[model samples]
Target: METDLLIIGGGPAGLHAALTADRAGARVVVADESFSLGGQLRQQTQWLSNLPGQYGYGKKRGTWVNEQLINQVGASNVQVLKKHTMIGSYLNGNIGVSDGDKTFEIQSRKNIIAPGAQEEAKVFPGWTLPGVMTAGAAQILINREKVLPGKRAVMVGSNDFSLEVARQLNSCGITVEAIVEEKNQIICSDGELVKTLENVPVYTNSTIEIVTGAGEVEHVVIQTPDGLKEVNVDLVCIANGFSPILEPFEIMNCHFVYQKELGGWLAAYNIHLQTTNPSCYIAGNAAGITDFGSILLTGEIAALSALEAMGFISSAEGTEQKSRCWRELANLESEKVLQARTEMLADYHQKHELDLPDYFMKIKGGKMYG
Candidate 1:
C-alpha cells in the first residue's frame, strides 16, 4: 500500500497523529495489533487528567476520550487496519505488516511509531497463579470484558494508576484488601489521583514477600515498614508501572539513549519528535513516560513534523503549531520529565553535531548514561 503517512498504533497517540496528518491533507493509514482501536485506553474506566486543569477543574473518562478519538478518526479520510502488526522495516523504507494471515508492505512518505508502552510484570512467589495479573489486565477484565477478576483483591502499588484500579475494582463490588508501595510515600504524579482513595488503605515502604493460594491468589504477605502483614484476598494486581515498547523502533534501526526518568531507553528525538531516522517519528508513552495530555500533545507535534517534512504544510506554520503544543505540554508535564526531555534533545544534537537551540540547555544533575 502507498500512503503519505503510516501510523503504527491505534491508541490515543496514533489516532491523534492520524487525525492531525489527515487534516493536513495527507493520506494516513493506522495499523494496530489489537482487534479494535484505543489500545489500553479502551480498558480504562477512571477519569484521566488529559487536559490541563482537568485533574481538579474538570473531568474526562478515559473511555470517553478514547471513543471520541475513534469517532473523529472514523469521520476522517484516515484508513485503519485493525489487527495489523508491523513486523519489520525495509532499507528502502517499506514497512512489513501482518494481520495474522499474510504479510503486506506499506510504503509511506513518513511513519509515526506510537505503539505505546508495556506493563512491567513483577514476579514473586505465587505470581504464576491464574489470578495474579497486572493492574492493566484486571482493568480490562472489569471495564472491557465486564467480568470481575475476583471477589477480593490485594493491590501491589500506590501510584495513581494502581489507586484508580483499586477504585474501579471496589466499584465492581470487589474488596481491595490494601494497596502496597515500595516507595517511602505514595508515588502519585499528582495528588488529585488519591482524592477518591481516601477510604482505601495504603502501605508505604512495602513489598510483597509472597503470595499463597491453593489454585489462585488467596493470601498475600506484604513486608511493610512495620513488618510482615498478611492479607486475605482472591486476586493480586501488580501495578509496578510500565516500560516503553521500543522493539518495533529497534527493528527500524533507530538510535536510542537511556533516560531512566522517561521509562528507560527511548529513541533519540528532537523538539519536534523526529527520531534519528529523519522520516520516522515517535509519540505517546513510546516516546517517554508522561501525562495523557502531554502524550496527545507529542502525537500532534510528531504529526506536524512529518507533515512539514512531506511538504503538506509550510515550515513556519509547523513551527508555530509545535510551539503552541510545547507550551501546552509544559503545562501538563512534570518537571522531571521536562528536564529529561531537554537533556535528551541536547544529547541528540551534540552527538550529531547539529546546532542546538539557545533555550535548550543541559539540565544540572540529570543522569545521562548514554
Candidate 2:
C-alpha cells in the first residue's frame, strides 16, 4: 500500500491524525492491532473535557468519542487496516506490517506513530501467578469483553486511574475487597476520596508484598508499617501505572529521557512534535502522559506539523494550530496526575543543545540507562 501518510496505531492519536490529514487531501492508511480502532480509548469509561478547537469542549463517554472517531475515519479518505501489527521501522520511507498470515509493505511520505500505552507490571513474588494481571487487562475484560475478571479482587493503586478501574470493576458486579496504595494517603480531591471511601476502603502505605496462589491467585500479602495483611482474593489487578509504548520509537533510534510522570521513557519531540529524526513525529501519550484532550490535540497538531513538513499544509496555518494546542497541552500538564517538574528538564536542553519550548521541557523522572 502506498499513501501520503501511514498512521501506525489506530487509537485516539492515530485515528485523529489520520482524519485530519485525510481532510487535507492526503491519502492515509491507519493500521491497528485490534479488530477495530480506538486504542486505549476502548479501555476508558469517562467524559472528556477541554478538547481542541476542532473537537470543542464536550462531555462524552469514552465509547461515544471512540465510535465517533471510527465513523470519521470511515468517511474520510483514510484506509483502515484492522488486525495489522507494524513489524519494522520505516526503512527508505516504507514500513512493514503484518496481519497474521501476510506481510504488507506500506510506502508513505510521512508517518505518525501513536502506539498508545501499556500498564507496567511491577515484579514481585508470585506476580507471575495466573490471576495476577494489570488493571488494563481487567479493563479489557470488563469494558470490551463484558466479562467479570473474578468474583473477589484485591485492587492495587490509589490514583485516579486505579480508582476508576475499581469503579468499573464494581459496575461489573465484582467484589473489590480493598483498594491498596503504596503511598500513605490518597492523592485525589476530597470529593473523589469521599466517594471512593464510601465504596471500598483504601489501605494506604501498603504494597503488595506477594501474590500467593496455586494455579491462580488465591490471596495477596500486603506489607504495611504495622505488619502484613493477607487478603483473600481471586484476582489481583496491579494498577501501579502505565508506560508509553516505546519500542517503535526505540527501533527508529529516537533519543529519549525517562519521565516518570509521563509513564517512563518517552521520545523527545520539539514544540512541533518532530523527533530527533526530522522525518518522524511523536504524538499523544507516546510523547508523554497527559489527559485525553491533550492526546486528541497532539494528534491533530502532529498531523498539521507533518503536513507542513511535507509542504501539504502551510507553516502559518500549522503555527495557529500549535498555539491553541499548546494551551490545551499546558492545561492538561498543569492539572493532571503528575505535573511537570521544570527544573529537572535542564539536562536535556544542556546536553542536546536544542531550544525546546516550555511544553516540551517537562522532566519528572530519574535517569534511565538503556
Candidate 3:
C-alpha cells in the first residue's frame, strides 16, 4: 500500500497523529496490531481530566476519550488497518507488514512510529504459575474483557500503576489482601488515591519470597520488615515499571539511548519527536514514558513535525501547533522527564552530526551499536 503518511500503532499516539494529519489533507493510513484502537487506553478505567484539547476538567474517562478519537478517525478520510503488524523495516523507507495471512510492504512519504510501551515484569519464584500476571494483563481482563482476574488478589508494588490497579480490583469486589512494597513508604504521590488502599494492609520494605500454588496462585509469602508473612490469594499482580517497545524504532535503525527515568532504552528524538531518520518520527511511550495527557500532546507534535517536513503544512502553522502541545505537555509531565528529554535530544543532535564509528554494526535483536 502507498500513502502520503503511514502511522504504525493505533494507540493514542498513532490515533492522534492520524487525526492531525488527516485534518491537514494528508492521505493517512493507520496500521495497528490490535483488533481495536486505543492501545492501553482501552483498559484504563481512570478518569482523565485537564487534557489539552477536546477534554475538560472532570469531563471524560480514558475510555471515553479513546472512543472519541476512534469515532473521529472513523468519520475522517483516513484508512484504518487493524490487526496489522510491522514485520520488517528497511533503510529505504519501505515497511513490511503482515495481517496474519500474508506479508505486504507499505511505502509512504513520511511515517509516525508509536508502537507504545510494554509492561515490565520483576519475576520471582512461581511467577510463571497461572493466575500470576502483570498488572496490565489483569487490567485487560477486568476492564476490557469484562472478566474477573480473581476474587482475592495481592498487588506486588506500591507505585501509582499498582495502586490504581489495586483500586480497580477493589472496586470490582476483589479483595486486595495486601500490597507489598520494597520501599519503606508508599511510592504513589496521589494522597487521595493512596487513602483508598489504606484498608488494604501495606507491608513496607517487603519482598515476595515465594508464591505457592498447586495449579494456580494459592498463597504468597512476603518477607516483610518483621518477618515472613503468608497471604492467601488467587491472583498475584506484578505492577512494576514499563519499558518502551523499541522493536519498531530498532527495525528502522533509529538511534537509541538509555534513560532510566524514561523507562529504559528509547528512540533518540528531538523536541519535535523526529528521530535520527528525518523521515521517521516517534511519539508516545515509544519515544519515552509519560502519562496519557503528555502522550496525546507528543502525538500531535510528531504529526505537526511530519506535516511541516512534508510541506503539507506551513512552518508557522506547525510551530503554532507544536508550541501549544509543548505547553500542555510541560504541565502534564514531570520536571525530571522534561530535563531528561532535553539532555537526550541534545545528545541525539550532537551524535547525529558526527560520523558513526566502525564499531556501530548490526547486533542481535535488531539493536545496533549505540
State the C-alpha lDDT per candidate. 0.85, 0.77, 0.86
Candidate 1: where is the Cα deviation over 4 Å?
Answer: 50-57, 189-192, 357-370
User: Taking the tens digit of each residue's C-alpha lDDT, what string does model 3 give over 164-209?
Assistant: 9999999999999999999999999888889987899999999999
Which of 2 and 3 is ahead in lDDT? 3
181-206, model 2: which lDDT tens digit per residue? 88888855436534954668678898
Q: Tell me the TM-score of model 1.
A: 0.93
Q: TM-score, each model?
A: 0.93, 0.90, 0.93
Clashes by residue pair, model 3: none
Candidate 1 lDDT: 0.85
| Candidate 1 lDDT by residue in tens digits, 1-370 | 9999999999989998899999989999999999999988898767776463322456688788888899999999999999999999877878899989899899999999999998889988889988999999999999999999999888888877888888889989999888888889888755666777777778898889999888888888999888889988889999988888988888888888899989998888987798888889999999998777778888998999999999999988987787667766765677788778877877787788887543233222232221
- Candidate 2 displacement at residue 328 in angstroms: 2.5
